[model samples]
Target: MLYDAIRFQAFHQDMRIAMIGVKGVPAAMTTGGGIERHVEQLAPRLAGLGHEVTVYVRHYANPRGTKRWNGCTLVTLPTIRRKYLEAIVHVFLSTLHALRQKYDIIHYHGVGPSTLSWIPRVFAPRCRVVITFHSRDQFHEKWNIIARAYLAWGEWTAVRFPHATIAVSHVIQQFCIKLFGVKPFFIPNGVEIPSASIGSDRMKTLGLEPGRYFLGLGRLIPHKAFDDAIRAFRNVPTAMSLAIAGAPGYDMRYAEELYALAELDPRVRLLGFRTGEDLQQLLAHCYAYVCPSRSEGLSIAVLEAMSHGKVVLMSNIPENLELIDHSGMSYEVGNIQDLTRLFTFAAREPALLRERGERARHIVKLHFSWDSIVRQTDSVYESLKA
Candidate 1:
């Protein structure tokens, strides 16, 4: 088991819960990004809280056909597996299947999956429906106008239709209130502070030297702006390498663009789709972590990086700023020159990086624990009962 063994909390009444919308968990077993990472950490903790948790996973994402993981029941289901159709299609089937079960809570993870949240509300009148607004997906650059409009409706239904709505960020919480007149329970994403340092065997395999390379991690989508990170790193006059870890998300073209940009400089290495011990080593040993994403709700990656005691150089987007509380080094969004300066600074200034990194990790240790987040989510579920 990758988690610490905590005895079941007997104080809270055990509730039957079904988690929908993420690709799968453990995130190690799936090609999970943010939502998968969220569910991966969440489901097991909820189970340890004395709740019976069932996660609906797409078969395409988890091919091994595992039956159980981390004290939670894994119900693997089939999906269409297309770029646009996979998540929604899997969610539609999962909702129908989950409604038949005697669950106390049916929680949906993202705005795209929350479109079918009404099914549980109408059919399973006794079961509480909870939707987490993980991101404002309608604003993401990958969607066509038709898909964007549908996502807009999904966002509307997410807040209004659910029995209780949870927003991962204050920015998202406020957006729901201003646009939909609904106030959601604010629960930021959680991270586990790694108790022990991982060995550098994985790092050596990837040609990454400890404290020598900067790390950028996330899926290779257009909105993530990995090209910006590559372009910026190319301008830095140093031997320090840039190690970017992620796979092509919804579009392959964007990955091609990143590859083309990386070809210009040998210092950039795109290590694809790392998770588990491999990923932890990257976070634990890097000089700093980079998140060049253009959109987010609350980034698990950023929190995880901070939890590993690494300074995060994120784009100065509202969500990123909210997570770091202005404690991190921020570059102007999509400004290669500005990001280049930060990259240059990372090469030049090790002492300041260590100080900021320590403070950032301290903040995560004090504020964002999975145990606390599970309790807050349980409170929301209990509120639905009344």
Candidate 2:
């Protein structure tokens, strides 16, 4: 009954598609960050294109909610809350639940969840299995030896079991080909061009001014290197402040370290977890967006910043480089001294910075449109169907 109206609209083409592995939909509407956002944009658009879409979200993420998102159905399943066990356990239960759904496509996100893609392949042999390799999860420093080993196995399963695989970046696609000899469809993540501008009232509330602060947005994980931005900001001899917006993602110790470091500098504002309009406001109004991450799987935050017409400063990792197209600045990955120099340069050159921001926006709009991404993804599903 929840999606009754949508069901009627979509009755013409009931191509049942199941999206697994993400916490929830409407990325900015949910807490799962990038992967959630990826599904958020893709699922509803697919539904609009006349497919029956169902996104499996964890129970804790939804708690009590309607089964409908945009036009896609949400199936909330329960899972353990522990850091290491949560994803694997929820993915296991979701895969079991999906086995009975008789879907045309079972699409899994993240390498961690794709480890279980083999289940649907074995049980529901008729269902097409697809996994989107968001990143090399095992590269994250938060995981221990055993955890890394398990994730590496998950990556192997991702390449081996899926009927089709999607790589969010060219770097990831090449990695898959080299390791598994399997070519994945390259479907870059998409960003929306803002139609209307919201006034800076929200920025005012946060004691932030438009085009005055440098923004760092993403999870407060070690690999993200928010600390590098904080330290670099400390040395920049300018009145501009550094606003870091994100929650600690299963790395409490690292989070605590960042907070303590931020306290040492009066200019650093550790605004935890800004999403939706709050996130948009910061991205729209910032002087420059800094991504000091040592690792990435084609960062959504960076693309979003570029979409908002902000200059992006990132670590020189291959994934981050792929997004810029020579429109942004990069430092040596994990080199704080180099980041400090970049920050100082960004502070000094305002006209040049604005020029870069314009180029950044142009590149993202040209290369990463949501409509194009969804259509390409739909083609993958169709290929499997044939």
Candidate 3:
């Protein structure tokens, strides 16, 4: 779609881009990792513009060893499968691999991965090293003290080492300016605004009624705070169901915890991970979507919910607020009472949510389209080249 405007912007040879630190591209609905989804949306569009895009994917994530997906070249590399060591180790090896290849730009996608941003700069002198600071992973409860310290160093080094930095949320952009004194290019996460419902067949399969069940979707991790959503729902005392659609992350314990929690309430349904069409149908037919994440790098989950004309009931975190801009409802972050009250209000006043859902869809259409994001990212590349 972007290529139709300029055809090809590069006057000389097309720019080569190497993307590091994502789990894998052609992001399936199962993984649902934001960075992978972002790359999946971005890489193919970049490739459409006649640029050579190489994405380094994890061996375990890219199990089939896909050489290519859509238009981008997929490079699968090996790494230990441990939760703590997985990201940094893969990023280290990715940088070493990128050193031998001739590329115009090497983009690292996370705070931990950005620690290796300097490596490409040192070895590949002519290549521009770019880092995207999505969120400070150091604060996540899952990380150990040593990992937290290392991630903090990554946030520090990413700003200094990379030729340019991109912040995925306005909150992150402000943080970079205030703490690091470097103003990062603001390129928030993007989504496609669905024109029509793809039908609710999947919802029926899960025994959910159309426009009845509240939806929660994301990786089942501590930071996602799905437990809070469940707790808040318990306080609501409604006939409406709570359907959480997600696969567990490295930790299966959280999933087990959620299964146990769901046992307490018949209305709560843990649907596990829904495929693409199934997820789309769920988004289309839900009562409202809830995203009570404690931390985010500009959540793709929130944007997708908005994109589907669904009113999102999310925590009042800066990043979440920044996306909705009052288009959706919010409760105090991590406050069970506040969330419970909102859920009660939602159950009583479905009409209010219907009104807000229209506004939420409008907001996404006006600001968060993927085509606009690609143009902005391309401009960032242009600046780096000059």
At residue 309, candidate 3 shows an lDDT of 79
TM-score of each: 0.95, 0.95, 0.96
Query: CA shift at 3, candidate 2, in angstroms?
Result: 32
Colliding residue pairs in candidate 3: none
Better of 2 and 3 by TM-score: 3
Residue 110 in candidate 3, Cα distance off native in Å = 0.4
Q: Model 1, 48-93: lDDT tens per residue?
A: 8778999999997678898889999999999986878988999999
Relative to the unseen true structure, what is the C-alpha lDDT of residue 192 in candidate 3, on a scale of 0 to 100? Answer: 89
Over 4 Å off, model 3: 1-13
For candidate 3, write residues 291-379 as lDDT tens digits: 99998888888899988878889999888889887778899999999999998888898788888888888998998889889878877
lDDT of each: 0.88, 0.88, 0.87
Candidate 1: residue 385 Cα off by (Å): 1.2
Candidate 2 on 1-386: residue-level lDDT in tens?
66955654443345899999988766654256789988989999999988999999888788677699899999999888888998889889999999999999999999999988989888899999999999988988888999999999988888899999999999999998998898899999999987556667898788788889999988889999998888877888899999999888876899999999999988899898787678878888899999998878999889989988888989999999999987899999888889999999998999998898889889988999998898789878887886
| Candidate 2 runs further than 4 Å off | 1-14
